[model samples]
Target: MDLKAGWDGTWQEFLQVDKTVFINELISFHSSLDWTLELEPAQRFAWETEYDLMKSMLGHVVRESNTNPETCWVAFEQELIGEGGKRAADVNLVLPTGDLFVVEFKHKTEASEHEILRANSDLQTMLRYHSESIGLVGHGYLVLTKPGAKEFKHSGVVCEIADKGQAPLLTNQLITSLRQTGSYDVLRWSKGEFYRQPSILHGTAQVFFDTKIPTLKTSASENIEEARDALLKLYQHAKAKLKRYVVVVHGRPGAGKTLLGISTVASVARNDSVKQSEPIFLSGNAPLVQVLQHTLDFYGKRKGKDVLGRAIDGRVMIEDLHIFKKHIKSSFGSRKETFVVFDEAQRAWDKASPRDSQSPSELMLFCNWLSSQSFGVLVLLVGDGQAIHRNEMQLEQMLADLDNSVRAQNGNIVAIMPSLHAKNMRLIKPIKRDVFNLKTPIRQSYTEHLDKWIEAVLSNNSALARDVALSIESDYPLRVTQSKSLAERYSVELQNTLHEGNRKPDAFRSGWLMSSHGGQFIEEVQKDKFKPGKRIGPWYVEPPSSDNSCCRFDAACTEFSCQGLELSLALFNWGSDLLFRDGQLVLAEDNRHRRQYDHYTEGSYRVLLSRGRSGLVIKCDDSETFEYLKNCGMRVV
Candidate 1:
């Protein structure tokens, strides 16, 4: 037989053995044959060992079945209703006194004391037997090979090989009485068993059911009834050429980035008739990769090999390509047809200067190789530009290059490149005043409170102080404090907090931290000395640890590091004079002592004004510059 067939045969044998053991115990308990002789050799030996253990542990009542003929009954397996409405017990014994006993026969050696106890607490079965008005007696029968001199106490009766001889006669008598009375009711109890909570068990079971599996619906595009149709069309269009291509899919979080990548891989696999290969899902963040792995594994198991095999080989490999490229190359080889999907592509490429190159950027190198080889490669870059990591600028640059290539090759880039940000807005509830497109901005009850909160932060009023005092308040003001030495100072303070009996930091949530430049600041934060708390234009700053603590800043330092992506608020130190042109953002022209401001008449000022979500906060030593920004619709703090 083949390996799979052999394994199947073994599995069937295991199941049959289990069923036989269950049946034999029930039949022997009800039969008139001698219990000791009636049992198989394995069961007899087991009964003897259990009896000896019980004798030593409990020192309880013990009698041979031959001596107590009145206690015998004809036992049969009975089904009981469970959470999913069906479960089975080993035996239902009918006594001469018209008492029907539900007995669960356990192979004592295989169960822990706790497990045995839990098994006996099958209250549903007991209730059902009771409701039937039969003489219901619940029991757990421990059959042993030999009776021991010592004794033990447990939830149920312990029977030995010596008593097996009388089982047949006792069973016959009970069956005869049960036949005469025509009714019996009794519950047999055992101890120390535990089952997974019903809901969890039901959920797991449901995952395997056909109706519970989730199906991929068609995208909201014209002429597409299913994802397959769209996928097929994409394949047909792309299949003619054997060239490297980067497909850019722009969407917000939860916009099916990973799903689209998987489906694309599945589509390619289907067209090529590949049996076992799945897309290599790559990401930089370890936690995010773990989440993807779990999700993929769940889907894989549900679909099983038949369905999954059609998509790829039986394996769906997910790894951090930054660290696993060598392993991947060695395993998969440099085959043209082997597709590699880079998820979170924005975070996978290094951002360090090309002149100061310490290590080669795998993403750029891979794209270059694919282009050089003229391979039919489909590279999907799925992530919003807003969410790109501060350290992965090279990948971003490569994506820009790919976009240029697409525009050159495809003629109209807009027609081929699709953005799904609008569709994603429907899936999630947004924070107050968060606008996607202007018409569909999020309308929330918290808008008024949020606006007031923003006002307080910008004004740096007494309310801002109070809000900062209660860091965990529901209406907490967002504070972004910029400092060049913040990382080192924050680390020292965190260590001090630990020394003062505070636990390790765990309140931080996972999200993207943005910065304009790659420098010591980013390195420090990555190393845990500095952490991101919130964003305020061009500067990502760590939140205060608690109301009692504050951000540590160097008092002598004049230059402050600001958040990267956008600039909202600008802070000037005490006694420091700063200048700002009307409607222009005040900024240091370079990382130098001299500071200069640009007038709003310059185009650069347009980008600055758009940075603020609501209004900008300007902390100026002089009132004039503050008033200038305030008049320009920026709230001065």
Candidate 2:
């Protein structure tokens, strides 16, 4: 009743044996699974089909033995808990040497990328567990039972497509491969590989593996997926009828508009209708674009070059908005690149002035080109409200451009937002039906209550903020320190907190959140540390090279630099420029912050406070201001 293939290293010595004897010995090592109408009792139609096929492959001897008392046990209905969540293995086989083999069954003609990813995830968990806990090896086998299942390879592993009665042999080979090599072909996240040091805000290099936890899809992402589906449906219709459409998708800060837009482009690459079309994903945020491009390059070095290269191929080109604008002017006709998705679309600039002649902003020009030249093109404009710059066009201006002469004739425009009222779009006719909204927030780890609390606190709604803050319990711990010395201590503590909850030291990301008004303090802090060190540029791009805490202390980024990014922890320095009096936010007389604090300071603080996913430590340098904040019910440490 030993169902295992008995791969007990005996075959290694059989190389000297006669051909017939070797063949017989090899066949002897081959094991069989006990088959009975009641034994496995196929759970589904696919399982029944696989079970019958397995029975036929086992021959009469193994089939007859199914009725006898069982001696071997195969793992079925197995589930394991991972750091992310619960995962299950459809079929598991234990080798004679105690090595494990797993099979993820797909009944369809082609196993999906998502299915492969799930199988790989299950494999990694089993491999890590068996190696660490049980001193055993685990190999993954992705089985596509149905005919014509597309075979593919990822990382170093492969998608196995098996015809009728061929699964067991493939499973044997998979186990043998694992036994031969300690590791399987899959994504093995290593420490120190993708290390990002804490910003000048926190002065430490923490190691963090890019392990995006697989959770239930958030409402925002779900809505985005639905919108993406709708987009594709429209695309299909447009393709058949030879029409064009403009779909606007808007969200608030931390609403995942960037990731959603990128994902939409990737989705288009996978679709059959527009798989051939090259997708152009453009973002005006240079740091965002650089981070994404770096992501691909970093993986190219870690993952085999050819693997990712093939996976990406001409499918996607993530471009800088300025570069795209420059290139689109010279290019003409409906090329292979048909789909265009723009992130932070609200930042698209409008034409300056007729007298100044700034080459007629990229917005109007791109819209004109899309309208007049491109055929059956679907444009997805993903907008957010992080417009910290002055020259940036608002959503209203972008819509006005969309309603221009060329676009109106070529395509119908739609506006979407994250709220009931599509802000600044009231001027457009038939606005009510065309505008849509996505209500959920998905980009941050913070919960709804935390989001509301942060918003209320930033908006100076003292009562509601206090109420919301008191009721909410979140991992994003907020602490306010009155003393400068305590603030310094808390900054380090926040960095340490970034390493908590199963996160590695190298992965911890922390930064200093300072207002733009504190330029003199930053300059003094910088000049004292490195004598001749230059002023701190964007923290995301030009972080201080020195690991010294003194140097890092000087490198603080304001809302303009740190927006659209998240940190694990942050040290928010509350300067004298903005203070709290009796519960209301009060701008001081010598206010250096000229960009409308009343309208934008709340948003700036919102951006800064929400940047830290784990925690925020606030430092109120002014004693009176600290006392005022304390009276406002903020947790003062």
Candidate 3:
């Protein structure tokens, strides 16, 4: 019989056959399998399920057929040879337009990796055959029962067959691409014309679009909310005033800049009229890009519409602002309704060299573009001046550049400064005042107690150490130093001690060690011969208990400073007559010119004061300094 007749007859017979008998056959195959034969049952099941789904997937391709006859022949169970004649493939169907489809079957019980590899291999082989066929078999598709297995990485088009309880739905995106290409033969072969199912697919995509995308909102603290509200008011005012306006928001680190940007986008997107012109969220940060892409993908699936324009549909484009600017200049040109939100505005404005002059800063150029747009466009700039910059301009100059850019475009500028440090500053007050008070009487009597407490807290409680470490700002400059030879000796000794004590020391784990120029230091001690679990660092002379040693480079010290110190005591030990000698509490006399010195001195003072939680433990290195501090109500230890 011909290929079409054979497929129809085989399908009818397969469906009429008793399901119990088919299942029994599968079980028998499973029972009588070796390594090669082990996959027989899964293969057999997949073949049957894929054959069933092909009819639905093929429907989409068939509808787009432009053949004179209006009806096309379908071939199944055909064996075909490739170019070298060394490989052969069992094809599921060949359409009248000469499109070759390699079908694979998969069950939920099959290993996912195996299925993916198999699908990829089959698609590659089909692509090879299709290329040789010279558009005869215009495209190749791998039809499978596994709906979620959609990512086939080969070049040519591919599709997935989603088996609904009643009838399967065709989900191969190749059909859409073929239709969009406007190639009649390719469309017919891909079955683009016949497939007309609803766009909603059962999975994360569906949930994201219908629910998550529409309701997406920015997370904000009290100050952030205030700033967001203010920005929204400005956006509305601009929208009313000139029908559009450019807004610039600048601040320091941990400021609520991103929060305001997201809120602005969400507010504009939620509007009924502006919903069609969805705000485009772009960023250079990989993690942030992934989050935004995921959000956009969810939105696209649920909406059942191409919301992010045809070019960006079902995909998130991540590129530098320069590339994005080129695209905008080409694609949108003078279109004013579409809103583009560029996060990380600092990177966009970097023009340090002649090479950069050609790109022009994205911030400045974008503002200029908004000014020239006929219908007016809203440009929002959100960035921190302290983080990373391309220029050597002062804060005043940076602000001036922003102001100049706004004025040059006749745009409005607004500033919002939200500090995480300022918000969390209150939480540390109790610990700072009563527990760490240097002038308190309790601190005077319990000088030794305070030292032991800090040691005990660091050694026994990892969580507390992490908290304390994080509490210390990065500005502190306390450093720890040790000779390289001594460090190596200590590392070997510590490893040996741990092994003798029946402890399995991890090479990666070491106690907090100090570095001389600020920052924690940890290094593995190398012995005469390399040994497993034998390592040394500044923190310990012997391998400390895992509970007693926090992982080096793993502590949370975003706002704190730490250093390794060589001391005789297992815990905190200090000499008698611990006295607070008058030590110079260095302060940054000038913030702009001496910022580094200012940070170091201020942070050192904070750390010194905060170290004695229960009371001040002052060791007098200088009598004058001690007398000065003592007269100031500090207890001398």
Best by TM-score: 2
Candidate 2 lDDT at 573 equals 81
The per-residue C-alpha lDDT of model 1 at residue 443 equals: 14
- lDDT for each residue of candidate 3 in 1-637, tens digit (9 for 90 to 100): 0011113222224434454565455445334422112345555665456455554445544455322223233333322221111112324443333544555443443324223433444444344333223334434444444445444443333444445721222333334433432223322432211101111111123223332211111121334445445555655555566544443444432233443455455555544245444455455433334334443454454455542234233233322344456665565563344455555554444442326556544555666666665434344444332232224343444445555555554333322222321123321211111110111111122333333333323233434433433332111111111233333333344334222212223222222222112222233222112454322221222223432233322221111122101111111111111222223332223333233332333333233333321122233333554444333333222
What is the overall TM-score of model 3 with all chains considered together?
0.31
Alpha-carbon runs more than 4 Å astray in model 1: 1-232, 240-244, 266-272, 275-278, 294-316, 323-337, 348-363, 372-377, 385-390, 394-399, 404-416, 419-637
Q: Candidate 1's residue-wise lDDT over 1-637, tens digit each?
A: 0000001111122223344464455445424322112335654444444333323321111132122222323223333322212233434443434444343334433433322332343332343323332224444443322334122344343322224323332234334443443322222212112221112112222222222312211132111123324434544554455434444444333233444455455455545555323335455554344334443444445446333234322234555454455543344345334456666565455522345466445454454444544343444444533322334454345455344344343332221234333222322221221111111111121223434443343343434434432432211112222332432333343233222212322211111122222112222222211355321211122223422112222211111111111211122221222244443334444444222322211212222222222122223334655454344333222
- The candidate maximizing lDDT is 2
How high is each candidate's TM-score?
A: 0.31, 0.56, 0.31
Ranking by TM-score: 2, 1, 3
- Candidate 3, run of 10 with poorest lDDT: 193-202
Model 2: lDDT equals: 0.50
By lDDT, the candidates rank as 2, 3, 1
| CA RMSD per model (angstroms) | 21.9, 17.4, 25.0
